[model samples]
Target chain A: SQTIHQWPATLVQPVGSPLSLECTVEGTSNPNLYWYRQAAGRGLQLLFYSVGIGQISSEVPQNLSASRPQDRQFILSSKKLLLSDSGFYLCAWGGPDYGYTFGSGTRLTVV
Target chain B: QKEVEQDPGPLSVPEGAIVSLNCTYSNSAFQYFMWYRQYSRKGPELLMYTYSSGNKEDGRFTAQVDKSSKYISLFIRDSQPSDSATYLCAMSVYAGGTSYGKLTFGQGTILTVHP
Candidate 1:
């Protein structure tokens, strides 16, 4: 069975501080990975998606960026955080059945 | 219009009742449909998926897709309190092997099953 994991399940960062969130998947290779953010009580907003190692497509323009350093490792980073950057961050990977598997998510609070 | 549209419903129902959630889309390229469930403060979980059109059932859940109408639905029979969560509808094109799973989602509908 495949599983996805995300780090720093919760975090609070000061405004203008750097941000880094990590995600890793096990039991799968070269799967598509995605980063999504959900504001309070709102729907998900796709931020970025990676098709393969070192290849990323950003869905929305913002302060955040994503990288796929390995076949199953994805990272979301920001040089400086904004108040609007606070939200629930989710990492998802495509499945063999054309479905998606999401991680536990990280609750980021930017003050 | 958005590519996909779903009612942001706070639909409430009693336990054991049947629950129906729906979404409509304007895109004709969508050949794959899916439903996802998300608990409060949690990531969305894949519940059901259907391709092309017609009905697909798995246990207590059934998924329906109408390609001509560009609509899809998810039905939960014998709804339980554990089923209370937000349901999101997503669709994608069948772009052959590698491009098959890039999904576009609609705003989710909130479902609450009371005990």
Candidate 2:
């Protein structure tokens, strides 16, 4: 079975501080990875998606960026955090065969 | 106009009652529809998926898609308190290259089933 893991289930960062969130998948290879942020009532917004290592397509223009360092490891980072950057961050993996699976998510609070 | 629209219902129902959640879309190119359940402070979980116009049922959950009307629905039979979660509707175009596997979601409908 395929599973996704996201770190720092809860995070509290000061404004203008650097931020990093990591996600990884197991039991699959060359699967597509995605980063999504969920805000209260705004729905799930796609932040970035990667088809392969180093191939990232961003869906929104913001302070956040994503990277795929390995086949199953995806990272989300920001040089400086904004108050609006606080939200629920979810990582998901999908493919033609592997439907879609989401991680537990990281609740980031920027003060 | 948004590509997808869903009523963000804070709907409350008694146990064993039937629950209906719906979403409407303006994009005719979308052919895949899905329903997801998200608990408070948790990630959304896929509950049902449909390829096109038709109905698909599994256990107590039924998913209906009407492409002609660009509408989709998720029906929960004998709803339980455990079903108290936000339901999200998502859609994507088939074989959308580069954009493949990308999903557009609607603002979720929050549901609460009291015991």
Tell me, by lDDT, which candidate is best.
Answer: 2
For all predictions, the C-alpha RMSD in Å is 1.4, 1.3
The Cα error of candidate 2 at residue B101, in Å, is 2.4
Candidate 2 regions off by >4 Å? A96-98, B96-99
Tell me the spans in candidate 1 whose CA falls farther than 4 Å from its real position: A95-97
How does each model score on lDDT? Answer: 0.90, 0.91
Clashing residue pairs for model 2:
none
TM-score of chain B of each: 0.95, 0.95
lDDT of 2 at A111: 99
Please estimate how well model 2 matches the true structure, expressed as its whole-model Cα lDDT: 0.91
Query: Model 1: per-residue lDDT, tens digit, A1-111?
Result: 899999889999999999999999999888889998988867788899888999999988999999998999999999999999999999999943568889999999999
Candidate 2 docking classification: medium
**Fnat of the models, one by one?**
0.39, 0.47
TM-score of each: 0.96, 0.97
The positional error of residue A35 in candidate 2, measured at the CA in angstroms, is: 0.4
